[model samples]
Target: MEQRSVGDIEGPWIEPEFDSNLIRRCRENWAVSIGQVANGVLATFIRQRVGLSIVVPEAKCRIEARYDDDSEMYDGELAAALADLS
Candidate 1:
């Protein structure tokens, strides 16, 4: 069986034009929005469990993609569900 790579993107992945800490802080908030985690490391854990071995990071596995498989639509549906709160 072939060990297919998932969500692996090319790197040095960081841009010198950006502040690494600031960028990391911004991305880290993603998990907080879902109440899924408290930090970048926890984001990876939630994403791995949620996506199984199917979805992963562009690097050595940290954080979920902005859009995972069916995630966008799922998010949309979730938004619709929450729209009632408006």
Candidate 2:
């Protein structure tokens, strides 16, 4: 696994310039989403064990990349999703 910096362009990964605060918020939100999903899965499993039917919904992990109005930022496949939302 290659480590990528904030704006490294040498590798295949998209290294768009972004606000550090945006990155931090995205990371925090990602962690919370993961924790919530794990908790839900655990609860559902435990309920099933007690003969209570339960269905755990799937979660989609989305890391949104945003840029200031003056800056241009685009990730290959991600561009479409971003554009669609806009």
Highest lDDT, which number? 1
Off by over 4 Å in 2: 1-19, 34-86
Candidate closest to the true structure, highest TM-score: 2
TM-score of every candidate: 0.19, 0.20
lDDT of 1 at 65: 29
In model 2, residue pairs whose N, Cα or C atoms come closer than 3 Å (at least 3 residues apart or on different chains), thus clashing, are none
Query: Which 10 residues in a row give candidate 2 its minimum summed lDDT?
Result: 50-59
- Tell me how far the alpha carbon of residue 39 in candidate 2 is from the true structure, in angstroms, after superposition: 20
- Writing each residue's lDDT as its tens digit, candidate 1 over 3-84 gives 3222221213233466765456434432232233223322343333432232222221212223333432333433332232
Clash count of each predicted structure:
0, 0
User: In order, what lDDT does every prediction score?
Assistant: 0.32, 0.28
